[model samples]
Target chain A: MAKNTSLYEKHLAAGGKMVDFAGWEMPIHYGSQLEEHHQVRRDAGIFDVSHMTIIDLSGREVRGFLQKLLANDVNRLKKKGKALYSCMLNEKAGVIDDLIIYYMHDDWYRMIVNAATRNKDLTWIEKQAQNFEINIDERPDLAMLAVQGPNAREKAHKALGNKILAAQDLTPFFAVDCGEIFVGRTGYTGEDGYEIVLPSQQVPQLWDDLLTAGIEPIGLGARDTLRLEAGMNLYGQDMDESTNPLESGLAWTIAWQPEDRDFIGRGVLQKLRDSGPNNKLVGLVLQERGVLRNHQKVIVDGVGEGEITSGSFSPTLKCAIALARVPAQTEDQCHVEIRGEKRSAKVVKPSFVRFGQSCID
Target chain B: MSNVPDNLKYTKTHEWIRQESDGTLTIGVTDHAQGLLGDMVFVEVPDVDANFNSGDDCAVVESVKAASDVYCPVSGEITETNEALADTPEMVNNDPFGDGWLFKLRPTDPNEISTLLDANGYQEIIAEDSH
Candidate 1:
């Protein structure tokens, strides 16, 4: 049997197509996926992402523990409610999971990790925290809802009421706490949004309230397209324990400052940085009429071969785009194999679209 | 939902076949298949004039999430293919029973058609599989 979220009944009531995802029954879509995708881009849409695991770390040694545990330094969080995106790596510098860590106080911090890697991440955190006076608690009583798009913040404010809405001024990548609710100005979609984490019991009402506020209930289908458009990497698809963040287009998430600080994978990362990786993750935009997809072969003239990690049709751009791991020396133009035919593509930096604007050149 | 026309036969795999008066059979993926697939991004239909056996993998449909194989229900020689699907694959999602018909076949053994499930039987299969 699959585990059900607090919003399972609500999702079924909304005519969702439920499927087993990471042991949880999740809505893949509510009717037309394309419509849901467009809804998040043009208006407002909400997703029940409670299946993601949230872990709270608390203790006097929390900051020191995090500085050594995460690739990104949490000390950079000067203000409360600031969030940092980082990759938890193994001893070999392979990415175990990409997560968002929220700084709440000197003694308390919150981390949200992928549902599929919950057990492994928990074990890894526990093993690392054994020497430090840190307490790690998984908060299963919390349910998360991501309300995204141009009208997302407004709809969330309307649903959450005025008291909680006062935190609406939070800058991007920041979070605010209002009693039991944690509101974050963050989302996978390249649009304005708020991801609210609240008690499980209050989830259904909040979902209903958001819907009443004219926010369409979206599902995982649109979530994938939205994140792809944002050039965000999906765990297990774009990178895993076998890949390092340096070659997965996540180098920016790594905080290399404070040279004395030693994170779990620092040594291996330093070596890799010194030696340079053979392949680098790059963005590819198809110049022809074809959809780029994962595992497709990429050919670069006078360079080595590579494979696409994530690919899809960009509804905003009305063209096919992808993230591929190509040879480090690969240049501007490359060919992606689509259905046994070579399709021309342009290699560019990622963050294809952001906040209603095109970021690709 | 459109009614399954009485003249066509359906397979458990969600493909429908229509036998024309000229003894040729037109086949297509059902609307239910397209809906489940979400959105159509790429399609790979077998070449015309190719021979296929029943249950053979004859076409490939790639949606945004994953790829699926469309099997041939009846053994036959492919006489014509739906060229329009090359450019407008969403036709399969919109009108699977009509313009989205994948290919036409001249059955090597016309008796194979008798073993296929009718609309009622196909509906029962879909309901059973839903569980």
Candidate 2:
């Protein structure tokens, strides 16, 4: 049986159509997914993301341990409540998982990882921590809600009540400890919002509060489209333990500077970087009527064939968009094999929509 | 909470059928089917005059997350296709029963309709599947 989040009943009450996702009974959509996508772009929307694993690492050697464990450098997070998005890679330089770590104190840090990758990620992190003295504390007692949109911040402020002042001045990519709830000004959707982590008992109340504050609950269906539009890669679909970050449109997330910092998979990644990646992750925009879908074959004439990692119709852009891994030489245009028929698509930067605006031409 | 009209018949795969006055039949997906698929970004309506056997994949319903095949509920020749859906696919989601009718067909054998499901039977199937 799939596990239920604290707000499962609330989801049912809101007419959510529940489905199993990553061993959790989650809502795929409450009603119309396109409308939910629009809601997050134009107004406020909330999501029950409590299935994500939260690990709190605290020890004197946490910083050093994180530096060696993550592909991205944690040294950049100088201020308190600052967050860093990094990928944990294997010895072969393949991504184990991508996660966000918040620096709360010198000896304490909070990490949030994907729900589907929780078990593997915990095993990997624990295995790596054997050489150092640090605590890997997974917080299952917490529930998370992502409140997102252009109007999300103000609505979240209204719902949070006493914690308003603490979160009011928070900058993007920053977080603040608001006594009972930890508010991070970050989200998967290409919108301004807060991902609040609080006690499981507080979740239902907060969900109702957000609803009362005029924020509607969005589901996983819209979440996937929103993230795909933002050019964010999903684990398992985009890349897995077999694909490296260089070929996965995540080279920017890799901290290659300060050559002395020998993080996990550094040597292999550096070699791959020197030789250059043969396949590249690029964006595809279908100008016509068809919707782009995952696993579709991307044919670039004279160049090697590629596969779509994540693809969907952009509710904001009103067209089909996808992230595909194709040959480095592939440019300008490509043909996607849909139902055995080759359809033309324009190749551009992976990001198609951000902040309710079209990032594509 | 999905609507199932009592006047029309349904198939196990969630397609709805309305017997027209001309003896031809209008076929579209049910509200339950549309609800399951989410928003209809595109609908690949079967070509007019196309003939199909029962259980054949006649048309496709593409949503944001997935593409599902709309099977031939009853063997028929496609008499007409919904042209409006080409420009406004959301008709499948907005008004699935009326304007969203995918095609009109003249059945090979009219008695084949009795073998399919009624609205109550279809609701039972949906309710069972939800569990």
Q: Indicate which candidate wins on DockQ.
A: 2
- The TM-scores, one per candidate, come to 0.93, 0.96
lDDT of 2 by residue, A1-361 (tens): 8999999999999999999999999999998898999999999999999999999999989999999999999998999999999999999999999999999999889999999999999999999999898999999999999999999989878877786569988999999888889999999998999999999998998899999999999999999999998889998988889999999999999998788999999999999999988999999999777878999999999887999999888888888899999998887999999988899999999898899999986
Error of 2 at B111 (Å): 5.1
Number of backbone collisions per candidate: 0, 0
Query: In candidate 1, which residue ranges exceed 4 Å CA deviation?
Result: B1-3, B45-58, B72-80, B106-116, B120-128
**Candidate 1, A1-361: lDDT as tens digits:** 8999999999999999999999999999988777898899889999999999999999999899999999999989999999999999999999999999999888889999999999999999999999999899999999999999999888778777874765768999999988888999988998999888999999998888899999999989889888988999999989999999989999998888999989999999999999998888999999987788889999997887899999988777867899999999998999999878899999998778887677877
Tens digit per residue, CA lDDT, model 1, B1-131: 53566677999988899999999999998877887787776677889999999999898776766677889999999999998988787788788788888899999999999999998888787788779
Give lDDT per model, in order: 0.89, 0.92
Instruction: Name the weakest run of 10 consecutive residues (lDDT summed) in model 2 chain A.
Output: A156-165
What count of clashes does model 1 give? 0
Model 1 chain A worst lDDT run, 10 consecutive residues: A159-168
